[model samples]
Target: MKRSMVLVAVLVVLLGIYWLMQSNRPMTDPDRPFVQIDTAQVTSLRIESSTDTVELARRGDQWFLTKPLEFPTAARMTDQALGRLGEMRKLTLVTDRPDRFREFQVDDSTGVKVSVTDRKKTHTFYLGKTSPTAGTSYARLDGSKEVWEIAGNMTPAFKRPVRDWRDKTISEADREGFIKFTFVYPKETISATLVDSVWKVEAGAEKFDADKNQISRVTGLLSRMSGVDFADTLAADAFDAPECHLIAELALGETLDLRLIPKGEDGSQYFLRKAGAPTDYVIYKSTAEVLMRKAADLRPKPEKSAEAPPQKPRG
Candidate 1:
């Protein structure tokens, strides 16, 4: 009787060890890609969550956001997401039970649904919380029972805010390529031209040297100007009476115009509209002040005269 009991104990231990090994092994074929789709053939991408949904459609080589109101998206941002999907590899099987989906944050209420459409079919998947280990995330196919531990931190690529997906660049130009800048105010106009590589300003036939440092700051800001956020409510006709108009003349004879329209009673906000662009943007108060410079603001400040040395007390 004692020998029979020892044999049963050994059998149970062996079974437990075997179960652990099988559970740790990779479930799916490691050679297979997690998402089998050619990124080049992709036509559209969409991400839906409980709070918001963002959709992007490809037009030839360019990509634009179609849902949540049509807007241009950053090419780099979209490209990175597509690349991640194309290169995803399943590391191991996390779970296969429907009841356990919520524990992994892969349920309908918590998971972020991502759909990638190509010419022939659309591939949909749900992305859950990232794994505690770096460079891994929980993912599951739309119709599959198995949940996977996929390589790469897929949360950032698939779960981005709407503002992060949209392009915020308001103006992009070469600073050195600017030859002249004209500021038009309600009552007067000022022109600053590059004379012999030095900045000179003309206000009502009065020509004088401009502050080179100030001119540098203005051109630098305009070269890579970006808005804090979009002004979706502002209409085109809202700029009927702009507080100031800035025209940047490039060396190639192209002009980039910006109109500043004040908002609110305290004038703490302004709508910035680029000439011929479909979208309007809002800039911070500090950025608006830089573009709203007048003739006097660009002129150099008067230097203080040096005081003479005091006479000696003996004299």
Candidate 2:
């Protein structure tokens, strides 16, 4: 072969090898694993910081907070964390020096450790400070020295306190096919019944129009009623002599009974209790008013005619 041709061939081979090395580099690999454990198979998880530790376990499909407090953890948040962990990809390697772990916030004394266990396998990693852009976070596998920036800021999910992790739902019930609804006020009691999916006043002081819109508004409110937080510390008897009561008896063999006790002389808030509920919950004054409406309040107001003002007859 010619000397110039041989030199050109050697240069081409060198460039090809360099490209291959760059392609296989960790930062460039697209399929890098962040947590290494399959989210669907994760049976339990533990998150530990210098001062606190949060433990969780999965039963069937629900995630429960077992440590720091034993309660059902919000499944939505837990699932979101698992999803982010599985989806995170390597961005860049930050450090490998043991002495620099403190600076990166991955040291045992400062860093937060998250571990997930499957049936027999387990995966654990430590998370550090997020990048300036807040788009990626620094992470390192347990027992490994290398620290790499991983996609997503992972702190939001695992660093939350027990209250933030718990399920805040107060109740879950369908409003359709409600057979009976009763409003018991201090002065009077109003009862309504549904026959063949139609609602009418069963008993009251006087006759009523059985306004559908008012009924619907109340139904919608009840359907979406959820507690802002749990007040399990409050005693159930505190609501025994409620100022008002709203009872919804459904055709589905379900009954929802809510009693509202005025919180203060102003009645701007209340300690709400549901029959058979383990704890009482707090609700805003406006919310209590909506739920504890009197029969008169449910009547739709009449609309005035939009006819033009009377004009003089060609005077």
Candidate 3:
């Protein structure tokens, strides 16, 4: 009888331990205000950094550097930021009627305050304790202020997605085959055939090394193209402004004080004038064969070497 009683006690203890373990497991759909994010839904983002402010926002599936116009933003960088945000954990703690924007000072820095607005109208949270793992960090979010204290691999914090402007402008067909490129610098008129292999400048005599970096930069700019973002595209246009025109004219070896005009069958034509140049080179999209033929025609015909001298050498 005593042995049977002992067995019953052992079974009860095991059952109790199992119940406790199950209870400790994170509750997925608890009747609570806080929402959990899994860190992968984030795609594109934008980060602005300046002397007085730093702001981040995600857009599309990439990240953009909005502070300095010249700085390049990478997609991986955005992923890292989202990953960090996801690593934060939510503590069971809850606060009633969370304070909204109490102007709390961050890091004891004057004039630097973190004003978090719940744009999604979700539950407010305050940051709590943090637990970090090798590849992940678990942080607690205060249910009141919607604030979270995150601790984890912080290396991903600085990463961001690169802004692609031409995502909608250039079609797949446009990316294929050789295209016509006409650049008008101050005193030089430069034309290039963009082939699959290289940018044959001035009819293949002068080839510009289309290295990975150059191609990446060009592709990045093109990817950001969109009709709605005409201002940014137009600003980069080399023919619209006098300064750009002059830069183009002077930068390009050959220029006729003319601007470059791009004409395509798709009704994509633009007049590009050198910063100070008066003339422009009209460029139209042409097939690779046509460009090659044009270049061949322009090549100086082989000088009929003195036939007599050739005959004497043969004899």
**Per-model TM-score on C-alpha atoms:** 0.80, 0.82, 0.32
Query: Could you give me the TM-score of model 3 versus the true structure?
Result: 0.32
How many pairs of residues collide in each model?
0, 0, 58
Q: Write the per-residue lDDT of candidate 1 for residues 153-197, one digit (tens) a residue.
A: 786787888987888898888999999999999899999999889
Range of the 10 consecutive residues with the lowest summed lDDT in candidate 2: 21-30
Q: After TM-score superposition, what is the CA distance of residue 92 in candidate 2 from its true location, in Å? A: 1.3
Model 1 spans > 4 angstroms off = 1-32, 133-135, 265-268, 302-315
> RMSD, each candidate, Å?
11.1, 10.7, 17.0
lDDT winner: 1
Give the worst 10-residue stretch by lDDT in candidate 1: 21-30
- lDDT, candidates in the order shown: 0.87, 0.78, 0.35
Off by over 4 Å in 2: 1-29, 264-268, 309-315
Arrange candidates by lDDT, highest first: which order? 1, 2, 3
lDDT of 3 by residue, 194-288 (tens): 56656554733454433333333333332232222112343344545331121111123432232333444463443333233222323222311
